[model samples]
Target: MSLIKKTFKTIDELKKHLKTHAPTFYYSSQTSTVIPYDKIADFFKNKEMTLGDLSQLPCSMELTPTQNLIVKGAISWKDAKDFLRSKKRNIMTSPTEELALISAGAATSATGERCFHFGNLRSQIISLTYLNFDGNEVKLNQDIALKNTSNEVKKYQKDYAQYDIFKNAPFPRLETQTDLMIGTEGQLGIITEIEIKTTDDFPVNHLFILLPKWEVDSKAHLEIINKVQKFRNMVILCELIDANSFEYLPKADRPNKEMDAIFFEIKTQSFNDFYEQFVLNLEYIDQDHVFELAATKFHNIRASIPRAVFEKNSQMGVVKKGTDVQVSVSQFETLLKIYQNFTKLGIKYNLFGHFGDAHLHFNFMPLPNQVELCHEQLELLYGHVLKLNASPFAEHGIGIIKQKYIPAFWNQNTFKVFKQLKDEHDPYKQFFPQGFMSLEDHS
Candidate 1:
């Protein structure tokens, strides 16, 4: 978003205010965790002055906030393993293997990075698994996580919506960056901090709309997704919902009131009087209409017409494969139309994917009674995705789910590059022998 006005900074005043408030903490807390808020509190109590005296906080200024974790005491789940190792000082059972799997799996699912690498194992999951490290370690002035994390993530996720606009922009500019790591399949990471770059002026204001499920037709979806690239102040992230899966969500499994909601973080100028106008746009989409959505994590599969999600079973043997392809938006549009049209021909697809980047996440689960017909449908639908240049190995990596369908996206040249990289990094291929090492199938 472009800046409308100018913002001037006074570094001297910013430092003066900090010195008065935190003479000791201002120097010590820069690179350390577990900053005791009591130190700053004692300073504030002595100053007799309040926070409002300053014109504004500096752009690069940071605050240290800490919390007393109820679940694991002072230690957070992110570094829980460390606590487990130090039996005398800390208390807990080390679920090292489980932690690794969760962090590794999150990285694989979110960004499609192909390896369970060592760095990912320690850095990613170690931070995410810990309840205290995620928020309490930051040392906030108030007790936020004392309630819940989803609450904190959502509140901040919404606050930082405008930040993702600059996501494809600069690397060092992201202050609210969170890391996701997976070791053998585990989730690790936390909102380490939020940074607001030193721009002359902040983003202009704009309106954001949250569209409900039924309103997510092809025409509206494309319009919203395309607007991000077109309008500088517009932000959109549509979250698809599946009713067939929602009814099965246990009352406890569902997210907060804002769950299953898309965010349209707007940044524009002259928004002071446009609040009413923005509400009109949101009301048109029926944002107030709340519905129960289904998730693969807890949704029941037995009662659904065709089961989409399945448990990873030891009895299941997977076919190894590798593929990666990038498709143009126009070509992807054609492919989506074909798939959407086939839905009428008694063909069912478990579809829930990110349209913002033109990535499709689909699973075939034909009716239990129609075995022969189901096979034909899978071939036809899978083939269409391949022909469009859309990778079958999209967002979700080519895990045990669609390994056999690798050929649909990979050409001879692309396949060769993957094999070459595989050999370079993993000559022995011990970490994941089945992954991309399809010696028989590649031939």
Candidate 2:
């Protein structure tokens, strides 16, 4: 599609623009993981669409220290962190994309490294302001306090359990309009501002534990991960760096090229506390294979893998294809077995991500000729994943690229309910015309 890109500096400007020209799509400022570039390029080639940019919306933030943060949607994660740091407070869990807009993360239900304990982006949100299809501003707030212990929230989850698409998603299900608006990928509304809960910014440290050769020592690697699983209380994030992903990292960042690694973060009050609670207690973890790094440096090293993957895809002129499925812990072993099939097919790939949550990203770096094969394999894999009742698009919301898979995920009745909800909220279908469910007449 030929996209007419426009940016608005204020909500008033956006409202004015909407009155004149209806935007068919909306995306954040950065072309980070949030944007579905391949879907837009391939699926809308013959269509002309106006793509609205929400990133330039006026920046404003109010921190209540240990309470909550009321911030404009356009505020970047880095800026939010900086502001919170000044007050000795921060979002309990933050997504890895520091440059991404916080509103984008909440809208897409993006998860952070510490998601296993603190929960995903949705957990942080207390209330949000969004513009509907008519460009009228509306705010949705949690009826009760933002706590999982609320009976209303639990009852809502139990009532809507049948319609839940992502089975293993974090708590606070579709209880209110706020829950519905989140993870809708702009299909419901354009998020303008958000109020999210915060926590004290305590100091922490990282542990990088090396593994034996992954391909040969697969059993050993799984056993190591099982060990890490027992220490969830102290560990904030338990990530896996498979051999394929390790190769893509810069030589300067890697400990060595010889082994895969299990990287995790832990609370660091003092040296003795760390040694007693984590170091000495984690059996089978040899001191020779383990080391520590500062949080900032460790994050940089971890972020490099995804950056390298995207760079390689760009260089090869191939569209990025990756899995974001999250299943129950019991099904994770099966998921790993399916990933191993990539070797049998001789497809070059990388597998890494939130090992603790049973959510991992498996990216395919196929040559032009191998793209078709990759698509076939992905379809088969997703089919298997659905059988396990996994959240097929776990961290990443279903943008245009993954919309085709929704039919299998949602029942006919559930699909109709969502369509009806969309019709009620956006009768004109002016917002995100062909997302989640296509309402446009391309013919």
Q: Rate the local accuracy (lDDT) of all candidates.
A: 0.31, 0.72
Candidate 1 structure quality by residue, lDDT tens digits, 1-443: 12111121343443343233211111111111111222334424543323221112232212113211122112222343243333322211111122222222332422311111111212222223221211223322211222233343344334334324211110011122223222111111111222111111223322223343322355544554444333323322223333332333455643423323332223345343333443334323554542323323312221221122321111122111111222345554565565556456663444443344444333434445444564565567668654543444433344333455555444454344445434443343322333333333354
Candidate 2 residue-wise lDDT, 239-304, digit = tens: 877778878876777774567777878766654555666566655556788887788777886788
Q: Model 2 — TM-score against the truth?
A: 0.89
| Candidate 2 regions with alpha-carbon error over 4 angstroms | 32-35, 38-42, 144-173, 270-284, 439-443
Candidate 1, run of 10 with poorest lDDT: 25-34
Model 2, residue 373: displacement in angstroms?
Answer: 1.1
Candidate 1 residue runs with Cα over 4 Å from true position: 1-109, 112-217, 228-236, 242-245, 250-335, 345-350, 371-375, 439-443
lDDT of 2 at 435: 72
Candidate 1: C-alpha lDDT: 0.31
